[model samples]
Target: MVYDLAIIGGGPSGITAGIYAARQKMKTVLIAKSFGGQMAHKTVDIENYPGFDKISGLDLIEKFENQLKGKNVEILSEELHAIVKENDSFKISFEDGKFINATAVIIAAGAKPRKLDVEGESEFLGRGVSYCTTCDGPLYQGKDIVIAGGGNAGFESAIFMQNYANKVYILEYGPEARADEENQKRANENGKIELIVSADIKKIQGSAFMEKVVYADRVTGEEKEIKAQGVFVQIGYSPASHIVEHLADLNQRKEIIVNHDTMETRTPGLYAAGDITDGFLKQVVVAAADGAKASMSAYKYLQSKNG
Candidate 1:
């Protein structure tokens, strides 16, 4: 399909861009395998989003999606395989053998949650393991859940799960959690949240799903097993930039490097936003703002071409 703007992701950035482009009456298409990106997996309350003092990540993104209804933007549920510059326009190929031609492209694929490379992790994904607390937390409601990592995300997930689970255990491999002191204090004060520091997951044990978690102490080397119905992994995240790696300039961390003010990449017609771009705080509001900047820059680029 031929379009004025082709957005490569459906997360906050891509959707926000679609809202802007569609409102401007541009022929925009948003192709993504999934919407909401990393925030979908966070089954916690988001206290940072501007309007709502506290809301679920999924709930906020749902509102974002509702904003796009009836807009001129065409939403495609497909995974992007490759993107190539074709003359003055860009041609994007999807894994499903579909292609789109556009005058400008915005990449906002975002990042993937980091995984624990321990044994049995892959074998038990979805049986008793989960990365998204929002999607899987309700399944284990009123039961015990084990959460790995101690960052703000992890603590937030633990606090969110406390509403449903009998108890939430937070396993941090560091002496101190990476979360802000206030958040850590709140999580620690929650009677339902248990914090384990300087611990490393040794292995995930179960028959079909996760039944137990084996962890070792970093200092003493002592090992212990915690029986739980579910395990949520929130170690960190890696940028999702493989498809556009060869076409754009990427930083050492594999995120696309873009001009801070314009959100334009080294390539003239290409732009990047959100976690896939460097130098911005990774948050829903910032990502939405990035998308707006990228879309405006894309509009200018297209206008200059016609001029």
Candidate 2:
């Protein structure tokens, strides 16, 4: 059967789009390999979502899933392979060899955090290595922790983690930190945070859990290690727009390009939202708003085509 709309993610944007589509009385199917994307897995505290002063990422994801159950959206847990446009409709193929047709599509597949790929990084996952400081910062209360990267994300996380970690070490591989001057000043002023420049991360070493982070001095060419209980990676993110790359236009960052006002891409009947799209801000609330706009735009496009 041809669905009226097919949403290609289960994150906040996709879930919100599904609800909005259901309200428009559209035959919608939401397909995602996993539910809740990064928000569910990485975010620990969500205080700026407007509805609740604070909520765990997993808890908010649960509420979104619960609300979706009462809607007319069909949920599919499958990995997408490719999307091919045929005539005026879209044929979405899955890695499992199954396929489905839809009149319009909304690609909300979000991005994933970039990894450091150092040794022990994978083995020590959940034990001491983490990608989201917000999720694992509290675990290292009164302990020392090392954060990799010197960009806005790294410095910002370092400042935020100061509340939990006794000492926050910010390591940068470059000659100097790349964060804004303001962030640099704040981090330097904070007694708990130590900004280390020209430090190249080598590996994470520990016996039971992560015990130390090894790095090399880029300027002096000397190796060193920092005793810490946890290592937080705050490099950046890579958008998950590979599946629909052939069907949509992508920017240099591999983010889907869409009209911000309507969340519609260059291709008619095709929309993208959330971190997958080229939006300035990557937040849960912003993603929800994108989803709402994409669904409404899809509904209007369908109405025009059918009439």
Model 1 misplacement above 4 A: none
Model 1 accuracy (lDDT, Cα): 0.87
Candidate 1 residue-wise lDDT, 45-137, digit = tens:
778888899998889888988998789889888888889997899999977787889999999999988899998889889987888888888
- Which digits, one per residue and each the tens of the lDDT, describe model 2 over residues 1-307? 9999999999999999998999999999999999998777653467779889999788998898898888889999998888989999999998878999999999999998989988999999999999987678899999999989998779878988888989999999888899989788978885999889999898999999999999999898999999999999988899998888887899999999999999999889999999999999998999999999999999999999999
Q: What is candidate 1's TM-score against the reference? A: 0.92
Q: In every candidate, how many clashes are there?
A: 0, 0
Cα error, candidate 2, residue 89 (Å): 1.6
Enumerate residue pairs that collide in model 2.
Answer: none
TM-score of 2: 0.81
